[model samples]
Target chain A: MYRYDEFDRKFLAERVAQYRDQVRRRLAGQLSEDEFRSLRLMNGLYLQLHAYMLRISIPYGTLSSAQLRGLAEVARRWDKGYGHFTTRQNIQFNWIKLEETPDILAHLAAVQLHGIQTSGNSFRNITTDPFAGVAGDEIEDPRPYCEIVRQWAALHPEFSFLPRKFKIAINAADADRAAVKIHDLGLYLRRSDRGEIGFAVTVGGGLGRTPILAQTVRDFVPRRELLAYISACLRVYNQYGRRDNLFKSRIKILVQALGIEKMRQEVEDEYAAMGDEREALALPDEAVAAMQAQFAPPAYADAAGDDAELAQAAASEPDFARWIERNTRPHKQAGHASVVISLKPVGRPTGDCSASQMRTVADLADELSFGEVRVTHDQNLVLPHVRKSALYDLWLRLGAGDLATPNIGLASDIIACPGLDYCGLATARSIPVAQALAVHLAGREAAIGPLQIKISGCINACGHHHVGHIGILGLEKNGAESYQITVGGSDGEQAALGGIIGPAVAAHEITATVDRLIDAYLRLRRDGEQFPDTYRRVGLAPFKEALYVAR
Target chain B: MDDPTFKLVTGNRLRDGAVVYFASAGIWTPRIDDARLVEEKDGAALLAEAQAGPPPHPAVGPALIDAVRDGDRVVPATLREKIRASGPTVAYRAA
Candidate 1:
């Protein structure tokens, strides 16, 4: 919904042109493969198995119907019939040709979308809550701030090449949907005691070869000094963070080496040195106003017959009611609902959307709701502002297009990376493992309850297995795909890295092993306890003991 | 531990021999494969090949390039527009 202004438009266009030239030079043998990899990663291109996978960013998971349509067109013309929406709210085309990439970028530029910072050991795509503007528990919309941060972080000279990839997530609500606590930098918009907007900044959170929760560096940073504070933090990390050892390069490693208190003190000292610089970085009211204006909520009509229709639908179609219960949520506008389209079916690849489905999603975004959709980090689509009265009609259309699925946060819904299927770094096939687990959980959807099962192809933690209530990491042992399960991982308000349950399970036994683990959980859980609550109450020992029952 | 019998593609489209990048006008011409294919130290060849595809135009958002070569497969991390401009065809055309 944030339209590209002239500055934003020109910035993106120039970047595309630069990349085009870079690409041409690389082809001409002026640049080598190793040299080109970093550049390409900065642009969100990955060479996966079978074909080249291109990841397009959906900044903070927001997209207009036009942009969505643009994505669909890209998918239809260049990739297979669909594109996979990623856990980072980005879209990936599984198949692409090397030569046609420039034209692809040119096409994206026409629609004001680029693939900058989607990858590489640099500051990556900045993510935020999908329900940024509409969520009821929000302080103020964080989208404007996210946009500001996006502009500042886009090729910032100082932090461009860091020790490792950096991720920043922002949240404006009491409920954390952006997984703020598990990022390199997490910003929470909160009103200070003086009634001024400020940010509660956290640092050192990341999941990769090593996973760590970010420590709260500053409980409250004045909103006016947001960018300056961030710059200071980055400066500290960039200076002291490891560069020699790729294994321990993340800011998280630095935070771990230095206790949270010391890290906090360091960031604070850096902030102090920044002094007047913070004031200069304060976004002018006009700029904030202009950015804020780009995200004005659409005019919403009264919820004339929303309740009645919803009630009728619930009574008439239990499945539809369950779907609404899982997928639909309150919108800022009256008589409207924010609908989430789940990419996870009973046994399809997680985050995999065919090009035709991409087009359908775009068309539906234009026709049914507003011409806008948001992708969630959990690998789902959000029609951010949709009229509640049109929920049924929208569902019908989406169902026709195969984009409508009831599961949103259910067990069947999974978050997975392109493991062995595409990623060369993958030890095991995450998508298949996810599919198998989904099959195991299929018939018992009710029993499954609300579970976040994330599968990462490897320790890079692209699938965010570290935060799943049931986290499964695929590893290679004796040249065979093996899985390591972690319990009690959470990415919500109280985020924590999951602890490994026990010995690794063979890949073929993954689904069965997970089933056993779930059964163990079901038995151990107290009345009305979620998986996270159960794991928290009893710890990993009980689960481990149950898992190795035979041994 | 690397899989043998591999060729490069621009984005995901397969290429013959070792061509790495796409030139202007959105055309991907064949280029000599980097020695890294035989020797791993020169990672630039692989990286350059992946990053060698056409860049996005200014009208598009900023272009970020990334590549993943899983054995014979070559994937460009930045490849939606190319897919959109051309119809869905997995294999590359003969140069």
Candidate 2:
């Protein structure tokens, strides 16, 4: 885990103090709503449907046991006794009081955490693969580069007020676990033919009112020039990105309007201009090395013998076996595995973890993993490293806390935003939809296999519905809540936006509609193909016919 | 066309950000039943009063919501308004 230095600590302390004064002024009625709006957003505070929401950044989805415990404390003391982990790898407290926000921020700062750059038209939280370092397929850990980007983007004067909120994602593994293609800037770390480390940069991909898959801008830029190249891209966007229209402000719109070739040329021109002073902008090898050193792999005991015991335990316990199959992934280490704690259990709102659950996970991290936890893009938690031998014990403990549902990538693992329930921008409710779908699919998840069901309250795509195998977008039609279903979207290695299947369905009928779609998939799928694969091969005709046709 | 005459004014309290409705006696209450119902002719005046509450009142986006009176209680006509008035339709633990 990366430890904050004295400089980081001091920076966060000053930021907390500044926000404290801002909150005080706002509460005293000295700052009008208009005046305090941007200021509060700068501190990652927002006035939502029912209450103030505080979005706290978990940089690159990485968290230490101490930080997790602090979050639990905040949840218990300041707001409600729970927090919602968002798709951006950040956690939001929905019931924050405006007056107590500063104190909560202070508490977070004490744990070397802050909500800086979590909102506004500034750089949002930097997200990466949850299995950053431990994944066997990873070429290099992306967290160090994520950290580098986080520091560079923090309070960047030039890019503070961009055309729209900018999001950056980095992925080092072959699988693209970070959902890179949907980010404003997607960096794929790779090794060149000559074994030099570099990045494949993609730009202009995002989901909101308009969803577009990012196009590659550069195939290879050396690691040292990563910052310069990113700065060049931002400069181009800052110069020409739309500011007149809120809906057309994202860089994806600009990229679409200007074309990728033109966009690439413009970025290349700016990059070349920066290259003239490359020594100043390019991160030095020593600096990169220093950052890399902070994310060095934790010491691992040589325990290849533990796998035999793990196998024996899995054979004896069916539930443990199922959990191992679904919730655990192969770690880079020989005797260790990365375990996913499912937050989307049936009958519960997806991504919500109570204070007690948070503390339990923290304790589990201390005892099992290396005192580290990772929040995934799918609103799940990850223990990046756990001994294969200790899987049974960990699974049992997780079960006790309602965290072990054995449905990591299954249908029950739904991604849902707090829709009309709490979000002011939502046109319809999402949590209820997700809950209903989870219950409907609970018994048939194993049969359906790995399917990503993402629900968004509005077109903002906070739940990443655009990339789901079955995307449910909630909208208001005529005075009632309705849903629009999309099919075949994915945010994996081959990212694609889902196509809307049919007209809007009533909220109450969504589960049955989804059931019809799944039944179509089941009927059409050849062999054991997943939903996305089957949908890709067969197209949406079968599902569309099944859905729209009379019973 | 939907009747826009029957309405109620609502906004979140500035101090705690709680969802509140403009009620009788110029007070904001967390209950929809406490909201003062107004006809289309009186909606503008009721909204003005709600927005012109004493200092440290609701901070953002105070507006009149189309509603209807059911027995002694006022019910929001639109789904969005209904959700705003009674919290989420689903079970949510965030008090």
Tell me, by lDDT, which candidate is best: 2
lDDT of 2 by residue, A297-411 (tens): 9898897998999999999999999999999999999999999999987979999998999999999999989899999989999998999999999999999999999999999
Residue-by-residue lDDT tens digits, candidate 1, A1-551: 57777897888788888888877876666665567777777777776645567888888888887887788788778765677778788888867766678888889988878888888777777899998898888999999999899988988888888888888999999999999988999999999878988899999888888788888888898877789989989988998999999999999999999988988888889988987888888877788888899888776667766878777877898877877888898876666778998888677787776656667777777776668888899988888777776778878888876667887888888999877666647766788788878878878867778889999988888899999999999887875778899989999998878999888988787777778878888888888898889988899898888777845
Candidate 1 chain A least-lDDT 10 residues: A44-53
Clashing pairs in 2: none
I-RMSD for candidate 1: 11.6
Comparing to the true complex, what docking class would candidate 2 get?
A: medium
- Candidate 1: where is the Cα deviation over 4 Å? B1-95
The recovered share of true contacts, given per candidate in order, is 0.03, 0.66
TM-score of each: 0.85, 0.97
TM-score of chain A of 2: 0.99
Error of 2 at A3 (Å): 2.0
Which whole-number lDDT from 0 to 100 does residue A487 have in model 1?
87
